[model samples]
Target: MSKTVTFVILLLLVIKTSVVCRAQCSQGAIICETFGSGPRGLLPQGITNFTYRARACPDDGEYTLLDTVSGDCHGQAWHPILEDHTPNDVRGNMFVVNASYQPSEFYSQKVAGLCPGVIYEFSLWALNLNRILTAGACDEYILRNPIIAMRIEQPDGTLIKEIIQPAITRTATPIWVSLSMQFSIPTSSNDIVVKLVNKGLGGCGNDLVIDDIGFRPVHPGLSIQFSNSPDAETTVCADTRLSLTVGTATGYISPAYLWQQSQDNVTWTAIPNATLSTYAINPVRPGRTYYRLRNTQSINASAVGRAQCSAESNVLVVNGLPDSPFSLGPDQVLCEGTTQAIPAPTSLPAGTTFVWSDQSKSQNLTVSLAGTYWLETNFNGCTYRDSVIVESQNCRLDDIYVPDAFTPNNDTHNDQLVVFHAGAFLTYSFRVFDRWGNLIFVSRQIDVSWDGTFLNRPCSDGIYAWTADYSVLNPLNQTHHFVRSGRVMLVR
Candidate 1:
């Protein structure tokens, strides 16, 4: 045989192998086809025959098979018409259609071996051939805009439903565009027909190519449940073993697992080598840590099957308590007969019990008498204790003295009017007024004294009427009020 005949035979064999591979479904996929078959029926080499035909074609059949490197029917090269190489064309071959050739033409196939009543997703990649095949002759009549329609029909040729109408627009470049839709198969139907139609008028630019068609069944939803060994919020000592369990009520096909840990309980990171349903943590740290499980897998099987299908388990927190209970506060003082309550540590772990020094099991201790108080926290078969000291004061009031005369002559002695023994009172107020009853001085502090001045200016020496009101704590811890009035001589 000649070299030319040998090359042609080799090419035919290669194309056949590609078509067989493309027709096979991927793992976990039901149906897939790349249209890599060589010329057989109405289509030329590299096109698959359609199952049914609706509209007629003027030049060729409803669809034609074309290689991206090959030109139009005139055999012109199509490199100038395409912007970049087709990204979605996993295989170099695809099926092409022109709507202007007739009213409209579609390539369809009957899909078999599907689970009844199960949801299945169908998807394919399409590209618009925007380059003009001829010059200005057919340019005016050609419509470059294109729309592709996808539909599902019963085996009897009746339209079951429109999966996708004329909605997808083709771009100017030969870039492959993806389209997909999900539908549930009817219980009575054993097979469904899928159609891909080019809805653009094809005088000049309404050329489209479709490839990499696929269909698959997938789970609708994902849910995960978690279980902890000692239960959530369990308190344990350092170096204790903790077990976390994760499971799914609806076991999806071949789901992946990942366990995550968090310190602040907000930001989380996956644990190393923790890809399993159960995770174990030995020698826990001396702080709080959170754990959760995540499951991910491929779902909604279609062109976008690799889209994220993930579910996360609920969070479980385990607290590690210290060997000794931490103190809530330092030693404190309380007035005599005044009650004081010591608060318990808020960091105490779960499953921990509190015991007061007075044989009480409450979280806090309230005492009216002055003495030392302590708290004991028990957790994880161990006991820890902390203490606090409380003191009381005895306050009494005998008498209060107010100076009636003062010499403000630049000498320190008797330079201001003042009150003495005022500290014995709980609350007191002193006010001095001029003879005209206009208030000149006022103070609430017991040690407050007034210089013979108003607004920082010395006042005339005169007798200023003064009034004092004070309260003292009696032996019963009740307030007793007293009012006294006198005259003070301000001799500047």
Candidate 2:
């Protein structure tokens, strides 16, 4: 939500320094070759001085540059995934700025058809130049200028544009200088080469090393932004994943990321596994929640300076669902005082028992009360205790029963069909018709009723007929009831 700029002397201008290091994939799981002068190379002079290091984060599995002396470039390595621009130091590579006498296509890859543009930004430490590349002032192939040229091609195998710049640092110590160039790409399938050419690597000769090579879209100016949403909230479940999108200008610089979560926002718990762009929320209370990101490194900060990271996404309230049913049965609501006899589970063919507001584990038990209750029984491979609620009845009669027969023949007393029942059935259903038999009225559950009318008008006095349906359990396992039907008379 806010912005700040920082500068780091990650690229040093140390000259003729005796530095050595070892580089490898995270966990030292894989080993690769390093650049420089001395023992390793086919050339007689040999390559040594520069080392592939597992600096500061050897244990965490990240590696970066290591200066032998107490210079500005000392620190852990960072590889910030950027958009619309290239990375800053690229971790282990030197930011050397070497100049050249002139620009030529010799070091440039030839453009085949249409070409995409590439932006290259590299910095050089002034001091460690002569030590890495095996070229110099007297070398004819090597330009007198410290600037080096490298070519990047398109996938179609054509020359893009040729990007050339002076080695990083050179004489500028502690100052972070960078070179950015956008080379038009070739219209071919293969990318332009950054290594070899017809004329001595376009002056790059033996060393113009690089590390973080980001190839992404380029966003300009103020659009460089970052966002995290819905702040924070509690969850009932144990696992959750959050999202984050960061905005950057000039692409992104040495940006480091860290996520921390906490039960009480005051003291955050650093979730080791919840990392990078998003945090995977884990087990916590089912109510309120809190989270935040610590900006270990920001895109606009100086290399040596550190700043407090922004607050994490807004609070997200999570409501977890029950993983397993409370008791071994499905949850359902029953009408209060409705004696729904429990029906032993059919799945447990061996037969099951029940427990409720009663003392018997009997196969059948009447639901004489209303409230959430649990049932315990061993079946199949596991035991289950179903937790359920029984709703209180709105009336003494949970439903209505109707018997056929009602005369609409101008009879004042027996003209309307009516429903009548006891305190047991939890639901009611009924339908009525005239002597001519046209359906005139109906009712379901406790919602609505009828007054013997057809198409919104009253029926002539006559005998009417009707049918009603209701439900009832076996009084043992509380299984669903089979349909029961009856008839009633409409009387006025």
Candidate 3:
């Protein structure tokens, strides 16, 4: 053969081999069937075989091939039996299996041309047709109870897995239920059989309709990790910025991101316009909020298949300074010569530091003098302050005087003798004695006076010795006692 012809032929052979290998190594195929074909087309292509029994007449023996619509067997009009239908099957023709014909009936199909060792998911929609038949009537003859089972079998008919659905009692209104299962293809087996079986007795109400069966390969290892964010339970000041980044992703060709937030850590809502791997939050609110990133990975390079995963970042707590700490109670009045302690709020946030106006680190302040007092608190880089005025009143006995002369004759001019201006005294006493040093008058009241008489009788006019004693409160809240004595001339 010529050299050019030989080269061209070898290139063509290599190209063909490459194309075949690519097709073989590709993802598993998606097998989906809506089963909308009419009665004649019940055994559709790709399905291996099916077995069913139906009564020729209402009372006749069970035969193969029941009717398509569920309403046909019940002799009553019913809405379309299928829950959802494909665009091609808008009329929603479905496969109806009646337990009156056979106790157990099924449709089986062989899933061929699947990539070995790959994971695949299968799902189908099933409706209990018996509910519609028993609607608006109490028909005891109808047995509408049935259980659906999806079985995965080996080529030799050995059971690999059987997913038996929960028993469904017939209700007045029937609804479709979707069931799904995920399985991994065995490395040694490239093809398997899937069977949909109705496991119920041969009775009236055990009728079922099924549609929209699907099997597709899925990427099993889509995951994400969080990074470049604060640790969990971190406290930051309000209005601070928190930055987070997505670490890594697996089993995805093109991954997209969405940031979500939650207040109570339960109900989460997505943050709009946050679709990048890296996200930033500035001016966070005062309360605690939770954040997480949702990662969506496209299984194929063309973005045909998609898988989703999420990673929650550490929870960042935003804190602010507590309410002003200076509260001295309702009666802020401080008595003179007494020590008072100003109180502060005790519900401050953790890691908070307090400083008094006088630079004292204690939360409360004690003072004997009066002035304007204030406090400042710091928490999570935020500062709070409050102030109050401390008022003090002085009622001290600083001066006292006694008149040197008095007349008790009732002329209304200097008619009695008394001490003048006795200020805020805790105790006081006054006494008047005759010139012979004999006591004639005494009083404990500071304002009381002697009328120059003894026992309500006029005393002989003469010089009398008088003495006064008193005590007053000092600035230190202590009593200071004093005594003064003098001679007073009594004229009548």
Q: Among these predicted structures, which one has the highest TM-score?
A: 1
Ranking by TM-score: 1, 3, 2
- Kindly report which residue stretches of model 1 are placed more than 4 angstroms away from their true locations once superposed: 1-27, 36-67, 70-91, 97-100, 132-135, 142-144, 167-172, 223-492
Query: lDDT winner among the candidates?
Result: 1
Q: What TM-score fits each model?
A: 0.36, 0.32, 0.35
lDDT of candidate 1? 0.58
Model 2 Cα lDDT, one tens digit per residue, 264-375:
6655566575445544454433445555554322432221111111212333344443232233345445665466765544454353444544556765555766666556
In model 3, what is the error at residue 326, expressed in angstroms?
Answer: 80
* Separate clash counts for every candidate: 3, 122, 4
Residue lDDT tens for model 3, 1-492: 000000000011111121211121223325454544435333433332233334321221222223244444445523334333334454544445433345343456666544443456676666665544434443554443667676777778877677877765555665766667777655566567777665655545554555565555665433223344334455555555666665545544455566777888767687877877677776556767777665534322221212112223333433422332335445466767899888777877667788888999975699788788887777756766777787776444555778888887888999899788524778888988897889999899976889888998999888999888888877787888888899988999
TM-score of 1: 0.36
Model 1: which residue pairs collide? Answer: 39-45, 100-202, 142-204
Error of model 1, residue 222, in angstroms: 3.5
The Cα local distance difference test for each model comes to 0.58, 0.36, 0.56
